[model samples]
Target chain A: MKELTIGIDIGGTNTKYGIVDRDGNVVFQGSISTAEYEEFRDYFNGLAIALRKATESIPFAHKIIGVGVGAANGNYYKGTIERATNLKWKGIIPLADMFKEEFGIPAIITNDANAAAVGEMVYGAAKGMKDFVVITLGTGLGSGFVCNGILLNGKHGIAGEVGHTSVNPAGRFCNCGKRGCLETYVSATGIKRTVYKLLADHLEPSELRGISFDNLTTKMITESAVRGDVVALAAFEYTGRILGMKLAETVVHTDPEAIFLFGGLSLAGDLIFKPTIKHMEANLMPLFRGKVKVLPSGLQNQAAPIIGASSLVWNYLDNNKTQLQEEVY
Target chain B: MKELTIGIDIGGTNTKYGIVDRDGNVVFQGSISTAEYEEFRDYFNGLAIALRKATESIPFAHKIIGVGVGAANGNYYKGTIERATNLKWKGIIPLADMFKEEFGIPAIITNDANAAAVGEMVYGAAKGMKDFVVITLGTGLGSGFVCNGILLNGKHGIAGEVGHTSVNPAGRFCNCGKRGCLETYVSATGIKRTVYKLLADHLEPSELRGISFDNLTTKMITESAVRGDVVALAAFEYTGRILGMKLAETVVHTDPEAIFLFGGLSLAGDLIFKPTIKHMEANLMPLFRGKVKVLPSGLQNQAAPIIGASSLVWNYLDNNKTQLQEEVY
Candidate 1:
């Protein structure tokens, strides 16, 4: 019998859903605007309707195992969405229970970063590797670390928050109310702040002059660097160096085989990769100096999250064969 | 039928050995000086002879299954001793191969830190935990991280070098050439430095004042603190606070169930533990606040290394049943 699973990626803006096969091929996918706080149950009902309509054309024998939801503050163990600062939801929401009620199959939930790490491991760049770290660079820095072929959930499911670690105690204020975090130097907003600092300190000339903080974006800096803008390019180098140094410290603890970069700002290939690798090498201890590799995510854009969420289902099916068989029997 | 394994803890100055059962019981134990590097083979031969003499008085058919050796700079995968700075050996030594050749049994070698971590998991404070980190605070700081019930040996078998990580870019010059290592503030030498800094800055009459750097050990400071010396107590508090903050970063990354502190500095108990736990809770990210526990090693004194090295043999024997069956068949 053909086996199928549902993968849900709930971002701050849109919630993307896909029906995926065992091979990670998405058969059907759709997107919907995330409901404002008041319409939580009604919004899920709408999602279920859309999903049923999309999968109606598939063969009847193919069985959908369950749904796997990936949200910003989702918890795998709890199957609920924790408080997300940007989301309209002010309290915990039973997302997995609602999904199960709609689909009549077991549901799995994981945080966005954890889902992404699993996605990279099962279908993306980290295939066949036992230890690796996935870093997502967007508004803030998010990381997922896999060690010994297992996703580390820590004791309270808060492991792999690499961004909050203090790299430079006096460096910059972080969104987490900490000082000198790696995210302060490496994230998209972090790069912009660096550009602003450079503009203030040096006598350099480029396109980023006199621009308001809101007007500046990571894309603008990348475009400027591509056009031979010295300040913009230096900003990227500076960002990558600090990130690499932080990575060097992390490697000392986790000792992953490779680190995979994903999400928005990671799109600046050599702009970030070159300097990050250089600084990581310089900062590493003698034992781990030259062995760790940095790679890019194979599942680009929306596919990354969908594939990551699907991987949870695939992994669950594989590891829980006896229980699944017992249920079927 | 009964089974036994020999666990060896090779130090720069002494070599400790024990025959252990599956339940972590030491059947027999002995120690010898390892000062002469060139005569390692001779030393082991004599050591084995002594062990055999001890076992002759026992009542069992004592078949040694394997030998697990823990040294300063050992690698598990390649089973090689990569030039330990403290030991006289200046080149790579295939110590496991030598042991296997002499004993006619499978042998494994790993760094002392990794061994200690394995020890903690199997028979020490971290028992029953799926994830934990063991920090050994001796002359230098050594770390061993366990994730999902397995040791994390990064890409080149050189992960978990947490001591060398820089907390302050301008803090202190580390032996590894890095500035502001965590060890620079938490180790015995680190405490001495803290004392001098406090004395120089505060002009306080400390029992530690006017003492030579070599003479002022962590023991003396702990003793002074026990006697109500303000400066000594302040030094412990300072060191613990720094260690706590560093551990907070560690918790965010690996998310171990608990962190176990072993070795000489941990002997101070409340002097280090009280302040370390208090400060760790203070600096933790809101998500991790009051979640992770920090505690001391259950394996006290010389038993730590013996239990740790024996854990390797037990783990290997448990996992290598196919090989064992093949040999028996």
Candidate 2:
């Protein structure tokens, strides 16, 4: 019989689940409205029923052995989701235990960025690498660090929140109740703000000049920059410079071999990477100069999160089990 | 037979060695002037002869099975010391191999701070912690990180160089050819520089007014602060604030549980810790607020480095051997 794992990627509005084999392929995939459910348990119960029907519909002999979840504020150590700002669930939800109860199979849960890191290590550009960082630039920035080949959950399982790390600490207001967070300047929303700021600063005409902030999306900025819109181009340059500077500071922490940029903003390609790499190199400590590659995600954007969730299940079940070194001499 | 490990700490001016048991007790100890020898090979040869004589004088029956050296620029993977500016040695020296040839035993080497971190895990304040960071505040700042209960030897073995991380690209000149390195504001030399700068900026009469930069020391500053000197107090506040700010930034990278302060500048007690902890907590991201502790090394100042070196041997041999997780999902 074929062994299959369920990979669930939970977002603020949508929740996607996939039945995947060990090779990161999604055999069957479906989505549900996450924001509609008043409670997460209700959502999970409905999701379990839908998943079972989908599994039965599959035309192959397979046994679902484990489940993996990638969600906001998902804590690997506690298997709980605690106070995720974007999620409808307000308090700590025992996510992994819910999976176990609903599916009668072992489950592992980690924040989305961590799942992405494991996915990158398992199936993306970071394959075969032991030390690297994965940065997700979507609505807000999120990060996961694989140091010495282990995804860092840290002491509290909130280790890789690079987006919340402050660049100025007093500059920009963040939803996390902090100021000058790197995400405020380098994420998709961050770039849009930059574009608007640039538009106000310079009088040069561009495609973005008359667009309002609510209507002007990151896609418009990318398109405008590609069309050689000076304001849009400067916005990307500024965003990359901030991102690169922060990454240089971050390098001293784990000394990652490579950093992978994923999700929405990274789709801009060289518009983001060139300035980020240049500024990162310029700000880097002398030792890390000419080392540490900043690369785009290996997998295409559309199926990446589901692939990452699937990879997480496979990774937790069969790969990277660390023997706890508890013996103190 | 009683097994003993040789723990050697190499400094610019002196080299300290101890014959230590697995319990971290020094059975025998000796020192040699490191600056006296022009060639590193001749120095090692002479030191070996001296160590042999010292070993023969020991009253107990002990077999030296392994050696551990904590030095500047020591690389755990390569087993070499590469371009240690402070040492008389000018280039890469096969330090571990040198020990092996001289003693006919296995040898391990790592930078001094990493040794301290391992030492802290094995014998000091950070015992039982899976993730922690150790900062050494000596002539220049240095750091070692223990992540997932293993000494982080990153991809290149130079992972924990928190000292070289910059706060501002144009703020301070560092010996590492980078401006605004953390060490320039937190080490023993760093605080001294701060004290002098404070004196230059202030007009108030103080005990530190006429002291030449050459004669000024961190010890004098500490004493002045204790004596209620405003200038010295302000200098410490400034230094601690900078250290704490950088540490807040550093925390996102590794998410350590506790931060252990070792070496000269740490001896200032609350003069540094109070402000450092205060600022660190203040600047910390909301998730890590009041969680990470800034604590002094549990081992006393005089014996800590040697003990850390000895602990490195025991920790490396008897504990914390990581099975490389090379399997990709």
Candidate 3:
């Protein structure tokens, strides 16, 4: 019988859940609205009931091991959601404790980016890589850095927030109150902003000019580029160039084997990839030029986060052997 | 008998060597002129001969385990010095193999910054730290990053090159042919350059104005600052402010336990430290406030690189057995 674990990716808007096996195969999965509720506990309780109902159909032959959760602002050591100020959740909700109590199995919790990194390590492009960075360019840019096959958890559990780094110090204002962060150029909002800037400078026209800010999406821009819109393509090209240059600078410090691109913005193929590669090469230090490859993520976009969180549990089980020296002494 | 290792720190003008025991004690240590007149092999032969003469007088109680060499441009995996481009070494030289043959022990090699980081981990402030970044702000800015208690050696061995990252995109031209690199704002060269800029920008009279570029040393500037030279103090403050802001961005990524400062520029103390710490706190994400620290390296300036390189070999020996995982059948 294959060992299984429940994998959960808890986002600000939705909570995705899956039953995954050791090999990273998700047998069953579903999602629920996170914003439909008033309290995180109510949503969590509903999730527990849904998981129970889903597993009831499966035979006892499949042994369930543990559960792993990936939240936008989860903490691994404390096993709590550190009061995601954006969410309605009260201060320091012990999600792992609640999950363990409900499921009678161990539960591990980590931030979404970290979980995605683990998933990539276990079942994606970084299968054999010891050093790599998983970059998610979505609504806001997020990153997961793996150095020497181990995730870097800094003193305050805030490692790998690459998006916050200012690529253009005087350029754009970031939501974090910082100016000119990398996310300001590479994310969905970042790209849209860039598109508007390019439109102002160039004589090119795009289908996106008339679209409202609320309706302006990365998908619409990508589609417009596909349909031969110069302004849309220019936006992606400009965004990719900035991202690539910033990545070259990052390589000077972290020196990863590869940088795996994930999320919505990464889907723009040659529009983003070509310019990003070109700019990265132009900006890279000689020794690192042509050494680091930027590629798309290997895991299914929807399933990656959940599987990544699950992989964290698997990794913890594998590495946390309590060191023989600790027992011997 | 305790194990002994020969540690060597090779500089452009001098080479420092020491016999270090298992507990990080330097039993016998000394320096020798590199004597640029000789060929690579001849210089190494002389070095080995001098080392042999020193060991002969110490009554060999512990067998030498290996030799660890730290050079400005050493490559750990290749065990070669790739033409020490910054120095007079104009051709590729296999320093490790040459030392191994002469000393009859395994030889390991790494860049000086990496060695200093290892030194800090083994015998300095980062003794028990699993995550930290060590910055050596000398003629150029050099960095060594440790994550999960292991050095971050990226795909091309140039992982910790934080100095090359652009701090101010429009600031100044860099030695690496880039504009506004972090090194352009924070290194010894950076501070001097800043002083020159300050002198040109303001109608200030200071001891530094008469000093030529070649004669304007960090020591002279720092001494002037201590005696209430506004321009000199302002240069340090500006340098520190830029460094602290950059460090804040780094904290968002690596979340290091502490940042250990090493090399010549670090001696500036509160002149640099106060502004650096203030800017870091001010620009830091709220989550990491009052958590991460920036401190002086505990390893003595002279001993850091050699001991750090030796510590790498020690770590390799200690973890070699446990690092390998058995293949699942």
TM-score of chain A of each: 0.92, 0.94, 0.92
Question: Of the candidates shown, which would achieve the greatest DockQ relative to the real structure?
Answer: 1
| lDDT per residue (tens digit) for residues A64-96 in model 3 | 777888776678777888866446776788888
- Write the residue-wise lDDT of candidate 1 on B1-329 in tens digits: 57777788888778898888888998888888888646656776777786677556555765777788888778888888887755776678888777667667778788888899998888887878988999988767889888877888776676788888876777987877678888888887898899888888997778888788878888898899999898999999999999998898888897778999998889999999998999887777666787888888988777678778978877766668788445433
Rank candidates by lDDT, best first: 2, 1, 3
- Compared with the true structure, what per-residue lDDT tens digits does model 3 show for residues B248-324? 87788788989988978898888888999999998886677898889988885667766877777776666673441
CAPRI-style quality class for the chain A–B interface of candidate 3: medium
TM-scores of chain B, in order: 0.90, 0.94, 0.90
Q: Which model, 1 or 2, shows the larger DockQ?
A: 1
* Candidate 2: Cα lDDT at B165: 81
Best by lDDT: 2
Clash pairs of candidate 3? A160-B253, A253-B159, A255-B154, B119-B308
List TM-score per model, in order. 0.94, 0.95, 0.94
Model 1 chain A lDDT-worst window of ten: A320-329
lDDT of 2 at B240: 93
Per-residue CA lDDT of model 2 for A69-117, tens digit only, reads 8887889889899899888778789877877776677778899999899
lDDT of each: 0.82, 0.84, 0.81
Which candidate gets the maximum TM-score versus the true structure? 2
Worst 10 residues of 3 chain A by lDDT: A320-329
